[model samples]
Target: MTGNLTRAEQKQQTRNNIMAAALKKMSEDKGFSSLGLREVTKEAGIAPASFYRHFSNMEELGLALVSEAEDALQAILLDAKALEEKGEDIVASSVQVCMQHFRDNGPLFRVLAREATGNSPLIRRRIQRCLMNLNHQLAEIIELEMRRRHRKITNPLYIAEAISTLVFNLGIASADLPYAKQKEAEKRLAHHIRIIYWGAEAMANSQHLSRNIMLS
Candidate 1:
């Protein structure tokens, strides 16, 4: 299997190995900031010098991890959109999907949540940027749904921001909970998401009523 790989493929495989090693080391107990280059290289079965061949420094490697996470989240967003188009209850379905992801990739996301608020300014910014991009993507989805349903909302972006913030905080809170507790947390999340939509619809109705009164 090793000999058949092209040089580029081998190099890419090594890079992936290094990334996997770093991610495996990260957890709620061991954050990205505390990881040592030597340990990661040892786990990857590469010399410490070989680490520099793939990453300029640990910060660059941290950014690579964040990039991979962004790809995963983007995939989730696409799945949510598909569910919406199918007339599924997107809020409940999305919460379940996100919680399942947390269960499967708990350490990876725990690292991201920690590093976003960690002492490293560069890592914080990169993770935040990824989240902001998700926020925008979600806003676009909300706006399109509003248009499809002929509903008037003041700003879908604000709704999206509220949903994103709520989900981020709640998802982190629930990630490590026991199965029953996690289900309760997810129920709360789904309820809050519905409330946000309901509140937006009420606000839109009020604005419409105000306009009618003014025209009269």
Candidate 2:
């Protein structure tokens, strides 16, 4: 027997379908500036009037997509961060998780990459806010790690922001790469992130050493 959906469930399903259609249409080629409400609704197999029932405008739908993508990205990174708390390999695991996420959500990331460079001021600002949140979460994690190890970072936020920005900006290309090329790209990303972390660790340790020397 087919179960009928409640009004709220139907509304949510329609919203999800609209967002899915938008993501499917979004890519580096089209960019955010070109997406129209009618086109999205058409792709979603719904009437243009129905789209207004869900999102107020195309920008609102795009922002919702951005919010969803950012949440997924943050969750993947946070899961990796959780593993680090258990003494597991952090950088490699995080890179793997990122690659997996990109592979699974290539269209979404492509949309993000295009939107980041597109001509829409509103979309740009929304993306920036999303990045800021991701950076803040990473910064907090880094600060805790440094404190636990009795080290002092000059600017954990800077490091975290740089890393988060790099991932968001460069990860789009990985989604389009072939298997071998994707592997190479992920490896390079892992190495670069490891280098950044190690560099910060070295600086923090040097500060610790100098403070000890001064105290003695």
Candidate 3:
């Protein structure tokens, strides 16, 4: 069922296929630095020189893959956010979303998490941007909750950043560790979130009480 295509359309399709193959290979193996262009080209079933036509180098290709992974993760988390607003427990919904995402996209997450910490400035920066975006989204949610309660949020950004780090680490740890270890880790993570939320609520209440006392 081969259809006729314009030259540009065929070239674009080939490039997309190459990128897809490269992403798949990177997901399977965490060591992106060790991957050669020739190997990727072979896996992609394209000439080695053809790789250069799509990307300047393997690092460029890796950055593209990282971007794709970031988008996919954002989509999953956004869906979870929608669920949270519909009477779902926030922490439970978040954990479920993360677990499902990891189960479905383990390879992409593995590659990004493993290589983003290395010497590649581009990959590192892209990963950092993704983290920042996540933090911003969480901060907005926290601020919205605060507003709903008529509470002032003095450090929502910092709180969001901390929570974002916690969530990211939870995802990475759960994905990388053994099955038994992952279960234990998830329990610990849920407990940790509860403690954090409880402490914040207590602090907010104390602050309110102190303000009332001062007014009196």
Locate the minimum summed-lDDT window of 10 residues in model 2.
24-33
State every prediction's TM-score relative to the real structure. 0.88, 0.85, 0.77
Top TM-score prediction, candidate number: 1
lDDT per residue for candidate 2 within 94-161, as digits (tens), equals 78788888788878777676787678788889888877777888888777766766666668998897
How far residue 43's Cα lies from its native spot in candidate 1, in Å, is: 2.6
How accurate locally, in lDDT, is each candidate? 0.86, 0.80, 0.74
Cand. 1 TM to true fold? 0.88
| Predicted candidate 1 versus true structure: per-residue lDDT over 35-114, tens digit per residue | 99999999999999999989999999999998888887787789889877876667867889977876766666766778
Could you tell me the lDDT of residue 18 within candidate 2? 98
Q: What's the lDDT for candidate 2?
A: 0.80
* lDDT (Cα, 0-100) at 154 in candidate 2: 65
For candidate 2, give the lDDT of residue 127.
84
lDDT of residue 50 for candidate 3: 87
- TM-score for candidate 3, please give it: 0.77
